[model samples]
Target: MNPEAWVALALSLKVAAWATAINLLLGTAMGFALARWRFPGRELLDALLTLPMVLPPTVLGYYLLVLLGKRGWLGGWLHEQLGITLIFSWQGAVVAASVVAFPLVLKSARAAFENVDPQLERAARVLGLSEAAVFMRVSLPMAWRGILAGVLLAFARALGEFGATLMVAGSIPGQTQTLSIAVYEAVQAGQDASANTLVLITSLSCIAVLLSARWLAPQRSAA
Candidate 1:
């Protein structure tokens, strides 16, 4: 294997890890809000949250590119205020992966939050526990297994993200190239050995994550 291949693998892992972490935090918060709150436009938010799951990855990537491009509103503001550029960079890959993987985490976390009995929360409140304390102590622990499963699922999704990432990050070798991008480039260039190796690695990673999620799911049910 070329040193470039190893560099691509490490960068891919780094991007995926950061993307999964951001998705886990944001998705969990969104899920909790959806399950517990009754705010105006809640339905709209829910629909938008699930949009990426339904849309083509290329479409999602295109929209993100526009939204994060230098001339775009948010992108302009970011560049002016923070002097940061997101497009065609490793950080951009992380953002794209997080956007695409968010729905999985949100769905899992919402279901987990809903499964916890409201009565338990009420009892905690009666016992003089603050809302935050009740949630941290009584609710979060009960849903920990589901949250773990959600995080794993998000991690898997992020690892496999290709279209959106490619469009936004541009497959720069040793910089923004990820496992999926590497595989695609190798196949295009008729580098079958490298492509095959990448495919095998990706498949194994996916299988391992799925198995772990399944194992954790049963624990959530038991709890």
Candidate 2:
């Protein structure tokens, strides 16, 4: 591993960590709402949220480019009003990774919240617990393991995000280039040794995260 490899790894970790953190808050809240609240178009909302999981990466990238490009509606406003530019930057990579990895957390959190016994929640409410208190003390505790499993999976997904990141952030060495992009660049440049090292690191990291997720996931008892 060389300095470039280490830089890519560090940048990848930074992007993944930020993306995961954003999803943790958003996914958990959205999942809990989808699980607990019955509303019109709930299924439609879920499908839309999960769209990135099934959409081709290039398509997703195109969508992002359109939305965040310098001339784009949101992007134009952001650049003009806040002096912020997301496209072609590491921050854009974070956004791309977050969109790509969000479904994992959302789906996991929904399942976890749904699996929590409504009776227990009602009982807490009966015992004079506020809705927030009941959620913090009872709901969250029961659903933590499953939620954590989803979080780990999201982290792994974010760490390996390639296409969307590439399109939105581009491959700027030591800046926007992530582990996956690094591997691609290495292979393109015929740096087989570097590519091999990056591939090994990525595989090992993802494998470790997946195993931990499996261990943390809720287990069904024998029927």
Candidate 3:
């Protein structure tokens, strides 16, 4: 592979890592809440969160552009107040990957949390463990493997994020250009060799991640 391809790979890894970290924190909390807390619109919230998984990438990109564009409401405030710009930047790529990959972690984490025995949590509470303590000591530990599987999947998804990242971050070589974007660029420019290299690398990376996730995921007993 060429140096440019290597750089794109590194950048994609960086974006995926950042996205996975964000998803780990946010997805875990939301998953635990949805699994344990009953409230009005709970299902509604889950549906909304899961929408990205099924939505067209271009559509999601449009939404992100609208919400984070220079003249957008939140974007305008952020740019004015914090002097932060997300458009056509690598950070924007991170945000795009995070949004696109979040649902995998959320769904996996929710299922993991749900699989934990509520009775164990009750016992922990009965033992005078605070809610926080119970979660930290019992719930989180029990669900970690499943959550990890989801995290791996999210990382893989983020690594390959294309349309949204391109829309929000554009394809700036060695800046905002990720592996997937590089592939697109290579193909567009008729650089078949570079495109093949990128495609191979991406496929291998995703395959490795999926295998790792499968290995780490909890196995079910025969019914």
Q: Could you say which candidate leads in TM-score? A: 3
Cα TM-score of candidate 1: 0.93
All candidates: CA RMSD (Å): 1.9, 3.0, 2.9
Candidate 3 root-mean-square deviation in Å: 2.9
TM-score of each: 0.93, 0.94, 0.95
Each model's lDDT comes to: 0.89, 0.93, 0.94
Please write out the lDDT profile of model 3 over residues 158-218, one tens digit for every residue: 9999999999999999999999999999999999999999999999999988887675554
For model 3, the superposed segments whose C-alpha errors exceed 4 Å read 214-223
Clashing residue pairs in candidate 3, if any? none
Comparing 2 and 3 on lDDT, the stronger one? 3
lDDT, residue 211, candidate 1: 94
Cα deviation at 8, candidate 3, in Å, is: 0.3
Over 66-86, each residue of candidate 1 has an lDDT whose tens digit, in order, gives 999999898889999999999
What lDDT, from 0 to 1, does candidate 3 have?
Answer: 0.94
